[model samples]
Target: MDPGCHKLYHVHGFDSRQFLEHYLSDKADMVFGEESLKFPIENLTKVFTEGHIKGDVLIDLSLSSMVHHLYSACEFFNHIIVLKAQDRCILELKRWLNTRTGAFDWGHATKLHADIEGKCDQLQDKEEKVRSAVQHVMRCNLEQENMTDPIVLPPADCIISTWILGAISKDQDEYIRYLRKFSGLLKPGGHLIIIEDLDGTYYTVGNERHHYLTCDEDFLRKALVGEGFVINYCKVQKRTNMSDLVDYSSSIFIAAHREKSV
Candidate 1:
C-alpha cells in the first residue's frame, strides 16, 4: 500500500466511540485489553505509587477518548485538564463525565485499576475521583503557538501523553515538533510521561486505517535527550496479542522531566 493512500489521523479525524469500543472495552475480543488497558494502568500506577512524579496540575493528551490512564493520576494530582484534537473525542469524554446515556462502560478498567491497588471494593469511588479531578476538557491544535490558543494554560507541573504522538506524527521530525510543543506547555523541571506502541506502522479503527510513525526505543531515547528532557524511567513490554488490525512490536512507557535551562 502506498503511504500516500494512508488516512492521516490528525487530518482525516477519528471515530472516538468506535475507537473506545474496539481497543479499550473488556468484552471486545481484540486482545488490545492487555496492552491498552492493563499495561498502562499497571505501569502508571507504579510510577505514581513510587512518589517520583508529583504535581498539582496534570495535562492529559492520551489517544482516543479514554480515562483509564488517569485512574492513578487522579489520586495524586489536584487538577486534570484533558486536551483533545477532535470534538467528538471531547463529546465522548463529556458524556461519561456528565453521566449521560450511551457513555462507554469503563467498569472493567476501573476494576483493573482497583485490583492492581488491592482496593477492589472501592471501584465506584475510584471512578468518581477521576471525574472530580478532570475539571476541564478543551480543543487543542499542536501546530499553534499555543495548542489551546487564546487561552494560555498555566505551566503544568506534569503532562502525560499516550500514543498520540504515534497517531498524529508522520515522521520523526514531526514527532519531535510535537514533543517541543508538549515541552513548551510544561514549566521548567516539569515532568512528562508518555506511553506509546513502538515500531507500529498503522492501526485500524472501524473501517478507517490511520497512519502511525514507525519508531523504536533508541530513537525515542535520543529524541528525548535532544529535547533536553532527562529520562527518569523507561519500560518496554513485548506484544503478546496477535492482531491483524495493528502492527506493533512492543509498547514503551517513559517518564522524564524537562531541564530548566533548555
Candidate 2:
C-alpha cells in the first residue's frame, strides 16, 4: 500500500506507530533498528562519500517518508529527485517537505535514524536535512516502460525503490520488467538499493488490505544478474512476529551496482 495514498491519520488510534516499532526493529530494546532501514542506510554511508554525494539520486520517496531511507541518503546526495507514482503521493510528500499542518508524523522515524548514527537527540536537524536534500518531486508510472516518461531526468548516481514493485507487479515476469526499467534510470556503475518483502502476498493498512508479489532470494538474484547487476550485499530478516493483517515471512535488503559497459 502507498502510505501517502492511504487515509491513515483519520483512522482513530491508528497503531501504525506501534506496529512499526515492533516490525522495523528488534522487539527487545530495538538497539539495531529494523533491517529494512538499517541495511540500506549503512550501505549507502559506507560506499558513497561526501565527494560523490553531489550527484543525482532518484527514489520513490513516499515510502521513505515513514521508513526514513533518506536519513542516510541526504547526508550524501546533493540532488534528490523523488518519483511519485500518483499526484496524491506527490502531495503527501510535499506536505511533509513543506512542513505543513498535518504531515505524516515522522518523529519516531527521525529519532530512530539519529540513534542509529549515535546522534540520539537531534531529531529536528535530521528531519531538516532530508527536507533540504530533496530538490525535485515528480510523477512516475511504474507500469510504463518509461518510468519518468517526458521528464528525462539526469541519469541517477543511485536509485532506491521500496515495497511499490510488489504492489504493481502481478507476477515474477512483470517484476523483472519493472526492475529493468528502474535500473535503467541509473548510470552504469551506479548503485541500486531495493527493500522487498519475501513470500509476501498481502498487507493491511488501517482497515484495508493490499496485495503483493511473492518472491524469494533466488528470483531476486536472477533478476539482478540478468539485468546486469553484480550483487554487493544481500541479507534477509526473518519475520519474528506475526499479525493476521500482514502475511510476509521475511524482509530482504539488496544492494547491487550496475556493471560498467565496455
The number of the candidate with the highest lDDT is: 1
Candidate 1 lDDT score at position 217 = 98
lDDT per residue for candidate 2 within 161-262, as digits (tens), equals: 777677566678878877888877888788888878888776665465556777898999999999888888787778764467667788777878888642
Model 1, C-alpha of 118: deviation from truth (Å)? 0.8
Error of 1 at 93 (Å): 0.7
TM-score of each model, paired residue for residue: 0.97, 0.80
Predicted candidate 1 versus true structure: per-residue lDDT over 21-132, tens digit per residue: 8789987585898899999999999999999788899999977799999999998899999999888899999999989999998999999999999999999999999999
RMSD of 2: 5.7
RMSD of each: 1.1, 5.7
* Positional deviation of residue 73's Cα in model 1 after best superposition, in angstroms: 0.4
**lDDT assessment of candidate 1:** 0.90
C-alpha lDDT (0 to 100) for residue 193 of candidate 1: 96
